[model samples]
Target: MNAGHPIPGPASVLAGARVMPVLTIPSATMAAPLAEALVAGGARCAEVTFRTPDAEQALEAMAAHGGLTVGAGTVLTPGQVERAVAAGARFVVSPGFDEQVVSRCAELGIPVIPGVATATELMRALRAGLDTVKLFPAEPLGGLSTLRALAAPFPGTRFIPTGGIRAAHLAAYLADPSVLAVGGTWLATPAHLERGDYEEIRRLTAEAVARSTS
Candidate 1:
């Protein structure tokens, strides 16, 4: 499936936001607490990935918190999209684009941000009607330089660069008018979650938001 087509909700809910937190949590129980930390710390959006076994439950937990714009990430299949939707995911994101997944999400009116790595893949996504995409492994894929190259051709597109992204790159990515936001897993690492150090998470969230808007 391709990207350009609109997903029929509030893209602004995710777009241009200062911080878009990406997390791979281990259990459903941590979702609320972590989400609370993020919001309290100033982040109002997140992408909860399915890398862990309890992803669906975690999504449910986070959704129940209210006020957060939560998206399901690492979504690789139609089945996963179904589960994520059932768990109340408002949007779906993947490391790469899959025609079947994109089609399914569209059918259900769910927004999808599929990954693209090159000019060819970016065009492929655009052909499939996707205007918003995720640039995975951002730094390895050429980081800010690659984004600049992409903008020349896909002038109307918006991106959310994930993977290998750091706090230092926040301003560079967010400064671009074509960039919607960025995703990274460092904010909610296992060690911090294990210790339930929500205060630190809140601090980091504030710092990330500040950097993105700076």
Candidate 2:
């Protein structure tokens, strides 16, 4: 995180991106085209997960595309946070909460949405001045039922539920006022990228955008 360049708030980022496409790019070369396809389909933001060897390079490429606000996902360490910010990530998302990672992002002035599946973790995030968090493994944790339960006690807290979410689940998730957005890998599957099916990717993204808005 650079002291001179502050990232946008998570609320602002998610507000514009009701359907945040979570991407796992295999190579740097595919990043720009993927970004272009997503943007052409009306996506405002995306997350490049650090699950592949070229994750950072891919993130850099997507960020350079200049259309969608790109961020780093699956970030687990403070070191990865620094790398993600250097690669032009506007935000950082972790599969779970980490005090060190949160501190590092705060030090760099980057918005971070750490995952929380329990009230204890949610309390920790709230105490740290974070009102937004990701409800990880959302389906396995009980889907909208779980989301409603967690959000009941915290009126102003916002959530961005991710994991195992599909097109059919979008409407129900977004219908909750507590949800800032939804993150999913369905928009750009690995097969779509492997086959260089940018059109399919574009169509999926457009369909998601339509679902989120409608």
Candidate 3:
């Protein structure tokens, strides 16, 4: 992750966040309060996934809320990259690394953590000048051991593992130095957002943070 640029790298975007909440908003209304609650829990960063129609508006609200390192997730297209930045996203993430999407983001100067599942995809990321990446659906992809094996080859790279990760599973990932951070949808689930359970979300976030830091 390069640092001397105007936009921060994945390292900076992910810094101080042991577990980043992967959020999907049902509407624009839930953005601010959700960000505030996560901030209260000591995690200042959140990934607002572009999975719903209201995602862009929600990202706009969250980024404008201030104090949060707001990132756009599930971004799959170059056009979405444009929209994400337009909506105030400080960083962008994709399920898989695409040359077009990455190049577009580079043109815009926004840091992107593209998803890679194999050595082949990782080589592409390296060629694209990316030092950090996301290991999507990590649990299904063999979890910690798999990452360890992958890291053995690309020692300079850092990984953020996402998908199907539970609170009980945070320690194993964080214990590895190659893991920059863990991104989990379990931090603030659809149920929590739908029910407006900021308290539970905060509590869960706090618990995860406490454990990750300890």
Candidate 4:
């Protein structure tokens, strides 16, 4: 274990999942129910972003639930890496590429997917030994067309487009082998999670899975 870190790398985190629902934990109470509901809907994995103070607790809560894979998103610092791994996060994702964060995650044995919006950032991530990366604010970065263009030079790289993705965009993205998975909040909106609407979460997850795989 590098630096005493124990979890496997990012490939394990992806786990062939078509959708990695980006989630915000409003409270610890929302973690387990949301995890169970996501698994019930066929998306057995979830990405709880470190966008709030509740993130660490929520990551811990979701990781405890059986049969669900939990990841930490919006990770930006070595401190966050230590916190996430301590909280049982198997993987970490950042808004933009940061060598320090990626290196820290590597030492801790947690897989990381850093965001890259251009060839330069992609090259940097690739140089960091990351074959897969997230495209931040994916739509404004040019969406699938942009992704297709970016991938032309790096055929072996895979992407997890995280921003602005909707149910309608899933099919096209998944159809391309370069897209490992799609991440977004639309699958489990804050409103649904806040209201404890697990059924809606499950239903949306199921449709997303179906659409992506179909």
Candidate 5:
């Protein structure tokens, strides 16, 4: 949240991108190439999750690559929010809604997308002035049917469904007008990164992008 570098709004950040690849980098060294592969394959945004020790460094590398709009995901605390912003994260995403984390992001002037699985959580997010939220574990939550149900009560709200989402599910999810973008790990799995299979990553990304837009 550097004042000099303005952060885009959540909707703007996700504009035109139908899929946002969720990445878990095992090593920082692979960050640049991974980002390159995704961008080359037509991705406009990505999320680097904080589930690994190399997350911060990897985020820095991806942000510096100057292609995809990079965000920090799996953030659990305000302290992690600060660290993520310092590492050049343009946006922040958490698995669940946390007032403290959202407040901290607000203080830093960065867009935060917190996960919500129920109307209660969705209400809380809307009350806090956030209309865009992540629908965590979307598949287990009943996928598109559940999303339609949740969106029914809040027409103005938008969703970015994540967790257990795959390429096969992309078209169906994106078909819903309420869905802003779909996030998934299949585009850049840990195994893909471990094997340095950037080509496969690029192919998957391209395929998903094509399917989403088509």
Candidate 6:
């Protein structure tokens, strides 16, 4: 596999703080406005989930937004990976780590942050040469306690816990030195998106960022 491309430095810079707002929009057309709201709210990046029908288009819109560091989320296949990169995603994320997807991303040189839930999955990711990965459905998988436990043995690995995460867990997750960032849909809830309440989204994002940094 060819190292396709270098992971943008901004990704590491932003993740170092441990706050990445994940967005699952209804359509790709909503991507730009939503991204603007997130950035205004203080988040410099977003993970556009493939759950929506317009995932690829959304990724393109967010990437074109300029200031926001956009990534493709919920990625499950190598085809999606290829399309995502072509659509302008800066990185790739999956609910679980798939060797084919991971290796494909590795070859493409795109920084892939796959999901993990147990020691087994974590170890698999480690063997694949990944130092950063996501902890899916973060809360149900033991949340902070689980992360604390994993940290001791895999001190070199960093996690971005997502799934069932709320603002309440923000501090605990970010406080952990090994946590690269936490992903959740809290910042872009359905009600907020339906109303196109960019201001409110922006405010919440800023608050989340401030709280994390504090």
Tens-place lDDT per residue, model 3, 95-122, is 9989888888888888999999999999
In order, what lDDT does every prediction score?
Answer: 0.84, 0.91, 0.88, 0.86, 0.91, 0.83
lDDT of 2 by residue, 66-140 (tens): 898999999999999999999999999999989889888988888999999999999988877788999998999
Per-residue CA lDDT of model 1 for 1-214, tens digit only, reads 4254445532655654656788888888899899899998778788899999998899999988996888899999999999999998888998997888888888888888999888888887787777888888789989999988987888989888898888888888888988887887777787888898889898888899878766
Candidate 6 lDDT, 66-168, residue by residue in tens: 8788889999999999999999988899999798898878777788999988889999888777788898888998889988887788877888899899988
Residue-pair clashes per candidate, as listed?
10, 0, 0, 1, 0, 9
Q: After superposing candidate 5, which stretches have Cα over 4 Å from the reference?
A: 1-8
User: Which run of 10 residues does model 4 get worst, by summed lDDT?
Assistant: 1-10
Q: Model 2, stretches more than 4 Å misplaced?
A: 1-8
Off by over 4 Å in 4: 1-9
Candidate 6 overall Cα lDDT vs. reference?
0.83
Which pairs of residues have clashing backbones in candidate 2? none
For the record, the alpha-carbon RMSD of candidate 6 to the native fold, in angstroms, is 2.3
TM-score of 4: 0.94
Model 5 lowest lDDT segment of ten: 1-10
Clash pairs, candidate 4, are: 10-111
Q: Flag clash pairs in model 3.
A: none
Off by over 4 Å in 1: 1-6
Quickly count the clashes in candidate 6.
Answer: 9
